[model samples]
Target: MDATFPRARKNQLGYKTSEVEEFLQRARRAYDGRPLPDDAPLDSERIRLTAFGMQKGGYSTAHVDAAMERLEDAFAFQERQIASRLHGDEAWLSEARTTAQVVANRLARPEGQRFDRVSRLALGYNVREVDRFADRLTRYFRDGWPIAIDDVRGVVFSAQRGGYRESQVDLVLDAVVDVMLAVR
Candidate 1:
């Protein structure tokens, strides 16, 4: 079914209307099993990492982002399913395992050491705090530390100089979670 989303009122700061609509149209087509254009990009990674422009009186950003995250999950699940069918279960699991190992290896490093720090001119998540959380995540991956997906989704960090890059951290988290879910 095609989902209808609520739009922001005039003067509200939200995501760009046209971009959301265009992307949602293609998302609907994919979800609804209709053929999409040849140029359409539906990869979960692409959707997860995409940035949207903000506009006044457009779609609410929080709402759009939530919806897109759901869409990305759906696509990722479907990707796993397709891969299983195409490559057989063992092969798919093998690939997912490799990806998970890579994530685990990276997370094993000290949080601040894992990703490049953002320029001082541009603010990002506080290095010390993110590294602390990264410690938790590393434990989770390395020693089966008791943390849930909610923890990953709910992470917040303070601003600091030369902090962990926001986009990089987010992308890595997304990738790790995607692999975990796919393999599970």
Candidate 2:
């Protein structure tokens, strides 16, 4: 798989290895329990450890493997979807910024022509792009909390619903923020 999606910016999640490691840690913890121990060699190694853990009990290795596989698949799918959405939003935002700059440049033109075509185009572009970004951010705030690097939404939701420690909410929120800032 391509390491970087959307843009090659350092802040973008797919482009940053550290955050990806953190995501895998969170996901593994969500799948099993507790963040993958610090001792684990790496994120990929830790995931392998979790998969290894599935075999410890003599129950059904096949079933355990299947469950782990499902969790991994779900995490990848959700991450990609979220990243793609953020990428689209960032692209639009950049376009809006460019449009604004162009209009500002044109403002230096003779005063009579100041309110002409370029100004209108810039205003329209700003409204469209800004509205899109605002809408997307609102949606993100509404939906972002539940999705985490660890694919632990179920755990977070159930814990919150059952009134466990509220910190889990913070953890999820932080992870979401990481994804947002990192992906953008």
| TM-score of every model versus the real structure | 0.81, 0.24
Runs of candidate 2 exceeding 4 Å displacement:
1-50, 53-57, 89-184
- Kindly report which residue stretches of model 1 are placed more than 4 angstroms away from their true locations once superposed: 1-3, 32-38, 118-122, 146-150
Q: In order, how many clashes per candidate?
A: 0, 2
What would the per-residue lDDT of candidate 1 be over residues 1-184, giving only the tens digit for each residue?
Answer: 4435566788788788788888887777776678456736567777777777888877777788788777777887888888888988898788777877887787777546888888888888888887787788778767887876646765788888777888888877886677666765
Tell me the deviation in Å of residue 7 in model 2: 46
What is the TM-score of candidate 1? 0.81
**Which pairs clash (backbone N, Cα, C closer than 3 Å) in model 2?**
26-150, 27-150
